[model samples]
Target: MMAFYFSRLVEIFPFFLRGLWMTTKVAFCSLIICTLIGFILGMLRSSNIVFLKRLIGTYVAFARGTPFVVQIFIVFFIFPEWGLQLEAFPAALLAMAIMGSAFICEIVAGGINAVHNGQWEAASSSGLTKLQQLRLVIIPQAMKVIVPPLVGQYVLLIKDTSVVSVIGVMELTRVGWVTVVRIPEGLMVFALVGILYFSISYPLILLSNYLERRMAI
Candidate 1:
């Protein structure tokens, strides 16, 4: 039976590949969205402005404090009542964006804050506008501190794609669950799922390590 199920898993491997593609798309799109929003919010978060900082703080707190699954449910199930009807894929992406951006925001804020205050004062003395200071002087330096953990967060985001399966996203983990129903080989099915996940995340892990070393210089 084990041999038969193993062969069955091999036979349906294409199904898993399709699921892998979906996961990739979700992760890629979410990464872009998270990075953009995270950077913007992070800049605001590290800013001296009291209202913007507190407002973003509240959002970051809520996002970090809540379970991701609950966030998905709220996006997928609750939003319809508010007259925002989103399909599963869009809803999954939205939930991912919200959750991911918050974490990334904190990472960006930490990175920006790590820059010496003298650097900011120097930039100001150079007569660069605030935006120019961040773009030209601050962010460039912060990238060294930011890139490693940011890559690490990306790995976590990719793995978190599995949670979207609860909203019917048909991602890799969802494929594994469906395959288990047919193959009735829970261990075999999920083991393959785990391998696929590793394949996706492992590259980012390598890149993170490389960035850590390179950035350390």
Candidate 2:
């Protein structure tokens, strides 16, 4: 029976490939959006402007505190009540962007905060404008602290793509669920799902480790 199911899976391999492609598309687009938004919010969170700092902090706290699945539900189901209609794929991407940016924001904020006070002082004393200080001095130094965890967060983001399946986006995990119903082989179906996820995430895991080591040196 297992052999027969395995053959069936092989025959439908292209279906899995399609799901993988969808997952890749979501992950890539969301990561890019997250990184940009996160860096901006992070810089704001790290700023001396009290109102901006507090406001961004509240947003980050809310985003980080809630479960991502709940967030997805809100985006998919609730927003329409407020007159924002979204399809499943866009909602999934929106959820990913919202959740991922909160995490990446903290990573960037922490990296910025980790830089010594003296560095900021030096930049200021050199007559660099606030933007120039960040652009020319602070952020470059902060990247060493940021890159490792940012890569790791990317792995988490990739896995979180699975959760978006709840909204019917037909990514890899959704494909696995649909296949299992037909194949009646949970282990085989999900094992392939796991392998696909690993294939996507493992290189990122390696890159994170490499960055950690290199940054530590």
The candidate that achieves the highest lDDT relative to the unseen native structure: 2
Q: Across residues 35-102, which tens digit of lDDT does each residue of candidate 2 receive?
A: 99999999999999999999998999889999999999999889999999999999999999999999
How does residue 33 of candidate 2 score in lDDT? 95
lDDT of 1 by residue, 77-163 (tens): 899999999999999999999999999999999999999999999999999999999999999999889999999999999999999
The global C-alpha lDDT for each of the candidates, from Candidate 1 onward, is 0.95, 0.96
* Per-model root-mean-square deviation over C-alphas: 0.9, 0.7
RMSD of 1: 0.9
- Candidate with top TM-score is 2
- At residue 85, what lDDT does model 1 achieve? 100
- Runs of candidate 2 exceeding 4 Å displacement: none
